[model samples]
Target: MRTLIFATAIRILTPLFLVFSLYILLRGHNHPGGGFIGGLMGSIAFVFHTLAHGTKQTAKSYFSLTFYKYDRKPHHNNLSHALRLLRKNIVRNKKEKPIFIWNYYLLRLRPTYLMAIGLAVAVGSGLVGLVMGKPFMAAYWLKVKIPLVGSVGTPLLFDTGVYLLVLGMVLKMVFTMSKD
Candidate 1:
């Protein structure tokens, strides 16, 4: 079902798509493109990969490069381990409670947290203006010189948050629906 030509093309274009996504995200604050558009562009690249390769292969490749490792084999769940440890500790000592470890394996691989974070950031940005006795989402800019990009503003942060939120939501939906 996989096409070699399409896979090769996707491999070549993935980096370009990522870079272009960043460009769109950065330019979005002042121009037409921002986080939502940038996120969609990035997601398209992944979708292209998923189409070229199978979903499992694409996810394995992507996760391997990132923090999470996508393992097909069934294994012990983190919550179960935590619960077992908690029970053991409770029986061993009444004074000390079981401490939940936050290791890499215990790390969240879901987009829900990302969505929450994005919502918080967007809300915080709006709240900043409110705290300053201004209307919500009032544009605030800081004039500064950079090597490539010129001036920046609070709108960029809001845009970035929006981008993350959209990206997470899209990825979550795609992965959830595609799962076997």
Candidate 2:
């Protein structure tokens, strides 16, 4: 099957993928690659690793509880860990895969439930605040005052929320699709 060969390729590609993903992630603030795309590449690399080895190996090498939630410490190590596990779910179903019900949608289990919930909270709060000022994506969001973080002058936190939400959702979808 392609899984075994893919596994070998995974070993070969993981390191390179990781290095490149990191480069992309770090440059995201200034360039086009940013956290979301960078996180996606990192997640794909880990998925390849998982396919080559197994979920247990994948979990040890990649997933952990620390990555699921948030970290208050300095630096962005948690983001790396979180992205790796975000989309990790059943890629190949041991049982029969379900057929799509319609073109409208299909159903699958997602692993980043908590992260999604948190994103909803942050985004909900952020939107309420944004509407109070100027409801626009590029209209100087940072200038809008937040009650806790500071005066209306920093939308970085909102961006962070979006990043987390997308990262978790994308990874979860990938993992689920693979499992199917």
Model 2 score (lDDT)? 0.56
Model 2: residue 15 alpha-carbon error in angstroms = 5.0
Tally clashes: model 2: 14
Model 2, stretches more than 4 Å misplaced? 1-16, 31-33, 65-110, 114-159
* Candidate 2 lDDT tens digits, 1-180: 347678778888988987776566555544443556766776777677766776556655555533233333454357774464443333545574442222323233244863676487446656765676756443234556445334432244444444556556666765666652
Off by over 4 Å in 1: 63-108
Candidate of highest lDDT: 1
Task: For model 1, name the residue pairs that clash.
Answer: 28-33
lDDT of each: 0.75, 0.56
Residue 101 in candidate 1 has what lDDT? Answer: 36
TM-score of each: 0.67, 0.45
**What does candidate 2 score on TM?**
0.45
Cα shift from native, residue 151, model 1 (Å): 1.5
